[model samples]
Target: MATTPPVIQAKITSDPVKLPLAPLLVSVVVGVVVATAGVGGMICYLLRSGKVPIRVAGVAPVVPTAPLKTHMVALEPLLVNLADPSGSAFLRAGITLSIEDPAEDKGKETNAGEAKPSSKDADAALRDTALTVLGQQTSDQLLAANGKERLKAELKSALAEHNPTVKVADLFFTEFLVQR
Candidate 1:
């Protein structure tokens, strides 16, 4: 028997994929540009809509005008008997008044003949008004929960009525004592 030679088959190879360089690069560039434009548009929209705040450099921030200057006038302590039935209750209170500084009014024009009251006279008037109001408060009224606040309000009103020239911005109780 004769041996037959084995048949050899040729190998077939496929070509690699080819991409157009110009179009690929153009598409990539276009995509990047579109994304950048979209982000910039969104930022502008937010800013225009006031959703994003813009701060300017080297600009002084808005500052509110300084509050008007105030002067504190402390009054002498008062020892007054209360309107209690037994007439034995008493109140010892130290108070201070906050008023607008008189120096601020220097620019205002006043009559040449008009004279302002002296500090002593003003202080005496304040003391008299405070004593009158305090003397009317009974021990029960002064001992209540809102006693101090009520007393302050009353004092302020009384002072305003009795001394119109002196504007009391606020009243403070430095010391308070009650005896029955």
Candidate 2:
């Protein structure tokens, strides 16, 4: 007896399933916009609440006020004998002083008979004070590494004591010589 092939059946559809592109794209764009807005809002909130610190680049901090104006007064050079043994050492120094202008200090009150000190008198006093301080230094002391700085401090202190009216802001040694 001859047997025929078993019968097989299958179903097929001719129509393809379709997806709408416009709605899909719109949904994706909306999602992205919402996410960006949320992140931006969070950052703004943090900054406003002081929870995050921000530093700007290439910007200097603001200064509160302008600095006081000062004038420089150059004194005549001084030559003095050093306080060294054998009387063999001497010093020659040129000094300049940075003094705050009295005109800028309007807060000070002067007496009726007390005339403001003249610049000439102040200059004379400064020269005298400087000579006195310079004559006390020895060649060895002035030749050290920090000698000039020490001398400046001494001169400043002496100037303040000798003349309270003159506000010495700083001192500069234009010329210095220590001969042994």
Predicted model with the maximum lDDT: 1
Instruction: List clashing residue pairs in candidate 2.
Output: none
TM-score for each model = 0.60, 0.60
| Cα lDDT tens digits for candidate 2, 2-77 | 9999988767888898999999999999999999999999999999999999988999988798565566788888
For model 2, the stretches where C-alpha displacement exceeds 4 angstroms are 1-63, 103-118
What is the overall TM-score of model 1 with all chains considered together?
A: 0.60
Error of 2 at 74 (Å): 0.5
Candidate 2 least-lDDT 10 residues: 109-118
Model 2 quality (TM-score): 0.60
Looking at candidate 1, the ten consecutive residues that score lowest on lDDT are 109-118
